[model samples]
Target chain A: MLSRKAQYAFRALTLLVDKYDQGPVLISDIATKKKIPIKFLENILLGLRKADILESKKGKGGGYYIKDHPSKTTVAAIIRIVDGPIALLPCVSLNFYEKCKNCDQRNCGLHEIMESVRDATLGVLENRTLEDLRTGKETLAKKG
Target chain B: MLSRKAQYAFRALTLLVDKYDQGPVLISDIATKKKIPIKFLENILLGLRKADILESKKGKGGGYYIKDHPSKTTVAAIIRIVDGPIALLPCVSLNFYEKCKNCDQRNCGLHEIMESVRDATLGVLENRTLEDLRTGKETLAKKG
Candidate 1:
């Protein structure tokens, strides 16, 4: 459903959310706890910070913290911030839109069908917040 | 939502299903019509044949055809056969199970949460068939 990068971002965010009130959590602590590579995690956190999803403090006491409440941060936001588009196809992507070279976007049945899948996927991810993920809540009701 | 291989598989399957009675449709014809790369598509069709999703003929006029009705072939089945497990996490995967190295599988909270997400994702993909996909029907119900 998500790339390795997105998974890493989610894990890192959840870890931060879990320790948000405990002052800034160090990247090393997060890497060790999550079993992710420290250097790779460093890059992910930097991307998140650049996206403003997280804030970093660069001292002995500083590590990383959420810039906003976990409840306000959706999985889709984190994924898009770290991995660009949530949609599999560039043609159907809302944030990273690009027309397929061989496609007639207006008339192609393939594009239409892919769009539905993309929308369904986005609806789920966009509505699922970090709070929901951390608390194990079904934030978005199952689409029957 | 799907890999390029899965998308190509679906297109190839649709073409075969549509022309199944017309004898095995040539790989060249399917690739041309579907606009998929010939070499990549050949490997995909071979994988499908190995998975029993497709049957292929060798020699003159040899091509491929769906081994079963389009409705019998689920997106999940095709994706799993072509792309391995449907779940993003090996720990959460049903068909391709792997225990998390650092966690106790029996009581891990992360595993429990991932299981729910995996189930939800599979519920969507497994219920969708090539027939539904080819007809451009949205398999997921609208979220209110």
Candidate 2:
């Protein structure tokens, strides 16, 4: 399951995407609108800013905004930035691979199974973007 | 990512599946062979037993064994029993559904995307059983 941080990240990102053309959005507004705790949302936004997914400005009209076009940013990228690897096993992860000492990757059934799962999950996340969230047309179609 | 407890649970289950027809295997042996911590494996095994996926014996040769036929037990079932929901979002979960305060499910892109992820993941996990893990035939084929 997604950590509250990740969920809040998604909520905040989607909100930013919704208001992308309207200039930057205040963090306080995002927190209040999305029901995210202010302090926690601040950290999450900072992480996104650091990842280059978000940009922030200072002064009177300063706030956060998506750096890239919403379509250029995938859900997989966001999740990886905020929630870490998508793979169930570190060894099967593409960006966060680590050798699992518990089993041999060559013959570990668990490893193979998780690899498939990772692929399946990435198929969805890597394809969906903030643009998709902003319009919500695809989301509504799929929901039905 | 899988929790250490969930990873250990899968390791222990696969090990038990490997020895299904060979009578009970000692927890210490499973811990050593699978590189799982002994105390952790003990608790994992007990949890499996409680879920009715495993059974134990006491006295001389007693230990743990898969309760159901390996072919009957899906990886999805084990994951749910040991690791909780496979869905990325609570709203998307079939067995562990919870409404998110952050977004409306009817139009939430994250929820829609996660629902697809859940389906894709379950597609693989529900089809892969302990028997598949034990023989490793399909796993090896896919690995190649």
Candidate 3:
């Protein structure tokens, strides 16, 4: 399951994506719109800014805005910034590789199974930028 | 990431899968061989047994064995038994469905991306049994 942080990150980023052509959006506005807790959303936005997915202005028109095109910010990148590895098993993770405790990677039973799962998940997440997220929702809603 | 309990369950189950045709194996043997803590492995095995994936005997000449063929017991089933949901998001999960905390499922941005991930993950996980895990390792090894 996605940690609340990852979910909130997705919510915030998608908001920024929708308002890309508009002026910056206030944290409070985003919090109210997304039902994210104000304090928590502030921190999440800060993390996004640090990741270079978001930019902030100071004073009068101060708020957050998309720092890069939504298409350049993949869902996988945001989730990783907030939730660490995309892989279920750390060992199979490309960004967060670690040895599985007590198992030989060469023959660990879960290794191959988890690798396929990781690859499959990456197939979607690494490719689905925030731009695709909007259209993806529309497509699925129509399918229902 | 998989919780520690889920990983331990896989370790224990795969060990049992390897020795299925043989007589029951001691809990101590599995714990020592897999380097799983004794108490934690006990709880994991109990869960798998309750799920009917493992059958255990008591007292003299008693130990644990796979309740069915390893081919019949899938890695996906074990993961779901131990970890609750295979889907990364609650909305996409069939068995453990829940509404997203603050988003409308009909049009949430993360929904479609997460659905694709869940589908891709399930595509591999639902079909790969413990028997395939062993073969998967060899195929991967040969490719390397």
Candidate 4:
């Protein structure tokens, strides 16, 4: 399941993707439009900014905007930034590997099964970009 | 990510599947083999029993055993039972749908994308069974 924090990130990002090239959007506007709590959104946006996925302006009409084109941002990247490993088991994680205290990954049945699940999930998340998501089209990735 | 509880549940279930029809296996043996805390394994086993996935026996030669053939249980069912919904977002969940406070599911871009993700994930999880996991085989469900 997506963490609440990650969900808020996606909600906010989708809004920004919609408003891309239209100048910065106010945090208040995003919070209001997305129905996220203003305070919680503040931290989420700040984290995204630091990750270089978002940029912010201060004072006057300044707010937040995507740093790169929405088309360049994949859901997998955002999920990793906000929610860490995409793999359900740490032992199977590509970027966030951590040996399980109890099981040997080499022979663990669950490890083998979760690896397939991880690949299947990444097939969608890695291929679909914020632009694709914003368009809300059936442009699902063709399996390679 | 899979919760610690769910991870433990999988570890325990895999052991029971291996021992199925071989007579009941002691809780202590499972705990030691899987490296789960005995008290924690006890509760997990009890829950599986209530769910009719496992049956418990008591007395000198008693323990726990899978109630059904391992091949009959899919990974998706286990995850749902132990960790709740497999969908990343509640609004996209088939069995555990909930209205998003901020967005209309019919129009939300993230909702559309997540629906795809949920489908991709279930492609692997809903098809693979405890038996498949036990064999550590690459019998991943081909996209249909």
Model number with the top lDDT: 2
Compared with the true structure, what per-residue lDDT tens digits does model 4 show for residues A1-144? 888999999889888988899999999999998789999999999988998899999999899999998888888989999989999888889889998887766667787778888998898889877786574544554333
What is the DockQ of the complex in model 2?
Answer: 0.64
Please list the C-alpha lDDT of all candidates, in the order they appear. 0.72, 0.86, 0.82, 0.85
The residue-by-residue lDDT of candidate 1 on A64-94, one tens digit each, is: 9988888788776877888788665788899
The DockQ of each candidate is 0.23, 0.64, 0.60, 0.53
- Candidate 2: residue B106 lDDT (0-100): 74
* Residue A39, candidate 4: alpha-carbon lDDT: 98
Clashing pairs in 4: none
lDDT at A11, model 2: 86
Please tell me how candidate 3 rates in CAPRI terms.
Answer: medium
Model 2 clashing residue pairs (backbone): none
Off by over 4 Å in 4: A135-144, B135-144
What TM-score, computed on C-alpha atoms, does each candidate reach?
Answer: 0.80, 0.93, 0.92, 0.91
lDDT by residue for model 3 (A48-111), tens: 8998889999888889998887888888898889989989889999999998667778766577
Superposed Cα deviation of residue B87, candidate 4 (Å): 0.8
lDDT of 2 by residue, A1-144 (tens): 888888889889888998997898999999998888899999999999999999999899999999989999999999999989999889999999999885767777777788899998898888988887864565345532
Query: After aligning candidate 2 to the native by TM-score, how far in Å is the CA of B28 from where it should be?
Result: 2.2
Could you give candidate 1's per-residue lDDT for residues B79-144 as a string of tens digits?
A: 899888876578889999876565555534345555655675666666666665443333444322
In candidate 4 the C-alpha lDDT for residue B67 amounts to 85
Local distance difference test, candidate 4: 0.85
Model 4 TM-score relative to the real fold: 0.91
Q: Rank the candidates by DockQ, best first.
A: 2, 3, 4, 1
Interface residue Cα RMSD of candidate 4 after superposition: 2.8
